[model samples]
Target: MVISEADHARVTVAVMEAERHTAGEIVTAVAEKSDSYHDAALHWAVLAMLGVPAVLAWRPELAPRIWEGLVESWSPQPAGAPLLVALVGSVLVFLLFRLLFTWQPLRMAMTPGATKTRRVRRQALALFRVGAERRTRGRTGVLIYLSLAEHRAEIIADAAIHDKVPEDVWGEAMAALLGPVRDGRAGDGLVAAIAQVGAVLAEHFPRGENDVNELPDRLIEP
Candidate 1:
């Protein structure tokens, strides 16, 4: 999302240069975030609701006033007063949490890292299939996907590249990307990653005579 025109051009040029020496197709994509994580937000809200009782238990002095506030009883209350107060407290807590989580920073913080990883990988795979898979004649397409909010990246290769290259072989490329990304240099990181990925592709799938570029060499922001 922070990428500018210069950054976009750099990525496109890197991809084109990488493809020149190899028959592999490379697609670069960036997303602000992979998911909204509504489920994580809901879970946080529910936990807040569940915590109300524990909180009230710690501050017993608050219970009587809270109960009186809910029913405004001038007379002795029935046995159900405690239940009413609890319900009211839980609802208030839940609502407060929901409101706070509407702020994206809080919501993202509450989401588990494992959940974000899964969503980011899932989204990258889906995008690669749509934007790169089988689009080239040799089926040597590769995708470099960056999710900014999660600070994560994924590399997806098509049939030919997958058959020739081991999954661990892409670790250097991933590292090249994340190093700069973590430093708030996403564009530079992406360019470095494309070069790394391209080098791997070139090594395994050298370009053939009259090789044609079957895919565009532009960055996709979807």
Candidate 2:
């Protein structure tokens, strides 16, 4: 779901077009994912591993069956054969769970939506600070951030714009941005979002005579 070169060009053009009528500097950014979320996967794997022993303990007969199946040889084994089998089985169970979590899709599935949302918001703010806020002359920079893996969109506007425009005012733009993302048309979504944002900014902050293009129109693909 990563944005391609063509998508980058489309978004850049959108930003350029949108900025023409407004003083707001619109920056678009797309990320593969907000976070690695490895910790969540590890927690899930540990829970699954722990369940193996609990299940075996509850179903005492199944433990003996597993032990017999593992040692079919008629050789005289120790009296603690069942306990040893349980220990080896538990180790194998833990390894299997850990290996399963190595798959990216499974690991992502184990992560909660709330965690993804928080991470996306954090990345968006960080990008805004670096890519738009510092670069814009009037402190009217806005960041349209998308996290493809998490299917989340975030809008981070600088203090100047945010002070006047309520947070809910950007809901329409955010919805437009996420609409295409939901359907795998990320480029189209970004363009639509830019247009919506431009309309809002144009109403509030029309381009001034000495207005300069303070920020680059290129897409920030971090």
Candidate 3:
């Protein structure tokens, strides 16, 4: 779900206030989802297709005639009957699962945490490159990216700050960011995260006389 207009305004103000204390450029971006995760969806579909045959083989009673012909008659079934049933059932199962997974909530739930994390990180880094990286006069740009569907966030810093700051240093900010997000308070999470990040930047790259607001203070919704 998209944040309210007030939340958008709050985010913009947070960025501006944060930037006031540090020369670092802070760009905030929120996305309903980072990636379609189509590959993961396809993988689950394929697994479902493959599983149908195994289930049929294990429980012949589910499709008895196809496996061993009529029980009373005891006739030998056509060798191809089971195979055909399996093929058709597999295709049907695959299609059913694929259709069900098209629903966003189910797909998001079924997706592995690692996959979501990787996709969020990848998207966040790309956004950082385009929106924040090296765009500042001091090469101290920071991007706080949040993926609502994935329930994950990424904090990417420009080269200067990245080189100086330990990656784990953002843990506190990320933690602060997600607590409110878990409660469906994404805007609050973002504001809190940006504040923490700003504190860090102010400490490392304190405001200078020649500091410039190199980036727009807006919440990018993409």
Candidate 4:
């Protein structure tokens, strides 16, 4: 495919921006670009290498005799040796490509920007469940949960709020539910917080019946 000069320049800028955010060296950015190119090269090389062997093995004049002799020479000990070898070799090539061309550079490229760091903290608060627990490290918090559908992790707070919570008693609860002012079990913590916050806002400035009735129209509008 033809890549326009403008597009190439844009990509180069993006790569540089990513490096700057992550605090990566100039050589690291260049190496990342080179590794991406190398990954494409290695992918094509492996396909060509395997295709050559496959084509030779499938030739009409030689294939039948070769198959017959191979079957006769095989023992009951292990039937998948060749297939296993090919699979293992393919895996090794892929791993090598990842090691040499992708991992380090991509990591450098992913160095968190300030905006990204802020977003992570917001997500932690958003996903906090009522009884969810938290563990802090440096500038981030680990929010843990045990729900069936949404069991995983989230990064919450930052160094700024690390000591803001009075004690560890409700840290998990706050981490799970975002605000200590809200109540209920961990699983329902977020819902409770939203309801409480909404209620507080509604009490101060209640919506009239006419405004509430207009909700259907607002929702249905294209």
Best by TM-score: 1
> Which structure is stronger by lDDT: 1 or 4?
1
Instruction: Put down candidate 3 lDDT per residue, 1-222, tens digits, no spaces.
Output: 568999999999999899889888889999999999877888999999999889887987666564544344466566576778788889989999999989878888889999999999999988888888878767898989999998899999999998999989999999999999999999999999999999999999899988878888899987
Query: Model 4 segments beyond 4 Å from truth?
Result: 1-115, 119-176, 179-187, 213-222
Per-residue lDDT, model 3, residue 182, is 91
lDDT (10s digit) by residue, model 1, range 1-222? 498999999999999999989988899999999999988999989988988888777776677777777665887777766667778889988999889999997888889999999999999999988888988888999999999999999999999999989999999999999999999999999999999998999999999999998888999999
Q: In angstroms, give how far residue 122 of model 3 lies from its true place.
A: 0.5
Clashes of each: 0, 0, 0, 5
| Full-model lDDT for every candidate | 0.91, 0.85, 0.89, 0.33
Candidate that would win on lDDT: 1
TM-score of each: 0.94, 0.91, 0.92, 0.21
Q: Arrange candidates by TM-score, highest first: which order? A: 1, 3, 2, 4
lDDT of 4 by residue, 70-165 (tens): 556554425544454445545666566456545544433343344334444344454442212232122222232122112222323233233543
**Candidate 2: which stretches are off by over 4 Å?**
72-83
Q: After superposition, how far is residue 60 of candidate 4 from its true place, in Å?
A: 56
**Which pairs clash in model 2?**
none
Model 3, position 124, has a per-residue lDDT of: 94
Better of 3 and 4 by TM-score: 3
